[model samples]
Target: MHVVTTPTGQIGRQVVEGLLRAGEPVRVIVRDPSGLSAEVRERVEVVRGSHRELDACMEAFAGADTLFWVVPPTPRADSVVGYYEDSTRAACRAIGARGVKRVVTVSTAGHGIETNAGHLSASLAKDRMIEETGVSFRALQATAFMENLLWQTEAIRHQGAFFWPQPADRVLPVVATRDIAAKATELLLNASWDGRGGVPVVSPDALTPDGMARVVSEVLERPVGYRQLSLDAYREAMIGHGASEAWAQGLVDMAVAQNDGAYDEHHRTAVPSPTGFRQWCEEVLRPAFLA
Candidate 1:
C-alpha cells in the first residue's frame, strides 16, 4: 500500500494524481475527506484524519510500503519549530512501527549551510527526525515555488508592482510545485535504493526580482516593477495576516538567510527542473493575475 499525507494540498494532490496515473494502489491520510474531489475519492482509499495524530498515522501507515510525507503549514502556531517537531514525532514512531520501506518528503534546500532559518530550519529538523528512524528516505529539497508569486497577483494587477524582503538584485533559485510532485511520485513508486539523502529541485536559470519583473512585464504586456520591502514591514504584514508573532519573526529570519545565499549550494549542484520563470509566469501567473 502507498500512503500519501496531505493529499489535498498543492503538491500532495499532484502526487496522488501521478501515482494514480501509474496504476499504484494509494491511500491518503486527510483530516477531512469531503474536501477531496469525487474523482479522487473514488480512486483511492481514504484514511480520514490528520497525520499529526498518532492514532491516525499508525492506522494509515499500517501495511504501507511507501509513504509520501509533507508537513502542512501552520501559520498561526505559537512556535514554528515546536509545531514541526511535535508533528514529526508521531510520524517517526508510526514509520518505525509499520516498517515502511520507502519514504519521500517535501523539504527545502540549504540543509547544512543554514541553521535557525525559520521555516527552512524547521523543515531540516523534520528531516533529521525522520532519518533517526533508519528507514530509507528521500528528501526533495526545493527552493521557493513559482506558485508563491500567485500571492502577489492582486498587487501586480492593481499597482503594477510587488514587494518582497529579499534584495531586488539577488539571484534566487526557485522550482515549480509540479516538478516537485513529479519527483516525489517517481521516488514513491520506484522503491529504489536510498539510505537517506536530498534531491534539490531547482530551475536552470536563477532569477532576481528585477528579472522576474521583466518576465511578468513581457507576459502581461504591461510594465511591472519589484520593490524591496523592509524586513520590519514584512513582519508586520505577516502578523496582520494572522500569523503568530514567532511565525512572523521566523519569516523575517528566513528572508535574511536567503539573502545570505543559503540556497546557493544546492542550486549549483542539482539538476534543474524544466519549468522556467518566464514559462511559469506566462502559464500560471498570467491567468491568475487576469482572474
Candidate 2:
C-alpha cells in the first residue's frame, strides 16, 4: 500500500490523483474524507485521521510500502518550529513502528544554506527527524510557489499592483506546486532509488518580483507592478491574514533569509521543471484572477 498524508491539500491532492492514474494501490490519511471528491473517494482506501496524531498515522501507515507526506500549513500555531518538530516526530515514530519502507516529503529549498530561517529551517529539521526513522527518504525541496501569488489577486486586479517584502530587483527561484507533485508521484510510485537525498524543483528562469509583475501585466493585459512592502508591514499583513503572531514573525524571518541568499544552494543546483513563471501566470494565475 502507498500511503499519502494531507491528501486533500494543494500538492497532496495532485500527488494522489497522479498515483491513482498510474493504477497504484493508494491509501490516504485525512481528517475529513468528505473533503475528497467522489472520484477520489471511490478510488482509494481512506484512513480518516489527522497526520498530527501518532495513533492516527500508525493506523494509516499499516502495510504501507511508500508514503507521500506533506505537512499541511498551520498558520495559527503558537510556535512554528515547535509545530513542525512535534508533528514530524509523530510521523517518524509511526513510520518506524509501522515498518514503512520509503518516504517522499515536501521540504523547502535551502537545506544547509541558512540557519535560523524560520520555516525553511524547520522543514530541514523535520527532514533529519524523518531520516532518523531509518526509512529510505527523499526531500522534495521546492522554492517559492507561484500559487502564492494567488493571495494578491484582488490587489493586482484592483490597484494594478501586488506587494511583497523582498526587494523588487532580487531574483528568486520559484516552482509550481503541480510540478512538485508530479515529481513526487514518480518517486512514490517507483522504488528504484535508495537512501536519503534532496531534489530541488525549480524553474529554468529565476524572476524578480518586478519581473513577475511585468509578466502578470502582460498576461492579464493590465498595468500591474511590484511594490516592496516593509518587513514590519509584511508581518502585520500576515497577522491580518489570520496567522498567529509567532507564525507571522516566522514568515518575516523567512523573508529575511530569502533576501540574504539562503536559497543559493537551490539556485546553484536547480534542475528546471517544465513550468515557468510566465506559463504559470498564464495558465494558473490568470484563470484564478479572472474568476
Candidate 3:
C-alpha cells in the first residue's frame, strides 16, 4: 500500500489523485478526514490524526510499502526548525517500526547553502532526519512554488500589483506544485530505485520577479506591477497576518537566502521539470485572479 501524509494539501492532494488514477491501493494520514473529498474518502483508507503522532503514523503505515511525506505548515509555531523536528520525529520512529520500503518527501532546493534560511534550513534538516531512517528515500527538492502567488491573489486582483522581498531583476528558479506532485507520485509508485537522493523539480524558465509580472500582465490582459519590499516590512506583514514572530522571521530569512542565491547550485545542475512560468501563470494564476 502507498501511504500519503498531508493528503489534503496542494501537492499531496495531487499525489493522492495520481496514485488513485493508477489503481494503487492508498492510505492517508490526515487530521480531519472531512477535508478530503467524498470520492477520495470512499477510495482510500484514512487514519484520522496528525502525522506527528507516533501512534497515528504507526497505524497509517501499517501494511504500507511506500510513503509520501509532506510537512504541513505551522505558521503559529514559536520556532520553525523545532516545528519541523517535532513533526518528523514521530514519522521517523514509525517508519522504522513499520518497515516501510520507500519514502518520497517534499524538500526545498537550497540544500548546501541553508545558513539562516529559516524554512529552507528547516526543510533540509527534515530531509536529514528522514534519511537517517535508512529507507529508500527521494527528496523532491523544489524551488519557489508558483502557487505561492495565490497568497497575493486579493492584492493582485484589487490593486493590480504583487509584492515580494526579492529584487525585481534577480532571476530565480520557480516551480509548479503539479510537477512536484507528479514527481513524487512517480517515485512512490516505482519500487526499483533505492538509496537516498534528491530530485530537483524546477521549471524550465528562471525568471526575474519583473519578468513574472510581465507574464501575469500578458496572461490576465491587465497591467500588473511587481514591488520589492524590505525584509523588515515583509516580516511585519507576515506577523500582521497572524503568523508568530518566529514564523514571520523565518520567512524573512528564507527570502534573504533566496536573494543571496540559495537555489543557484541546484538550478545550475537540475534537469528542468515540465512546467514553464508562462504556462503556470496562464493556467493557474489567471484562474485564481479571476476567481
User: Over the stretch 69-155, how does candidate 3's per-residue lDDT look in tens digits?
Assistant: 988998899999999999999999999999999999999998555558899999988999999999999999999999999999898
How far residue 272's Cα lies from its native spot in candidate 3, in Å, is 0.8
All-Cα superposition RMSD per candidate: 1.1, 1.1, 0.9
201-226 per-residue lDDT for model 1 (tens digits): 99887889999989899999999999
The local distance difference test score of each candidate is 0.90, 0.89, 0.92
- How close to the true structure is residue 259 of candidate 1, measured as C-alpha lDDT? 90
Each candidate's TM vs. the true structure?
0.97, 0.97, 0.98
Superposed Cα deviation of residue 183, candidate 1 (Å) = 0.5
Largest lDDT belongs to which candidate?
Answer: 3
Clashing pairs in 3: none
Candidate 3's TM-score: 0.98
Could you tell which candidate, 1 or 2, scores higher by lDDT?
Answer: 1
lDDT for 142 (candidate 2): 88
Clashes of each: 0, 0, 0
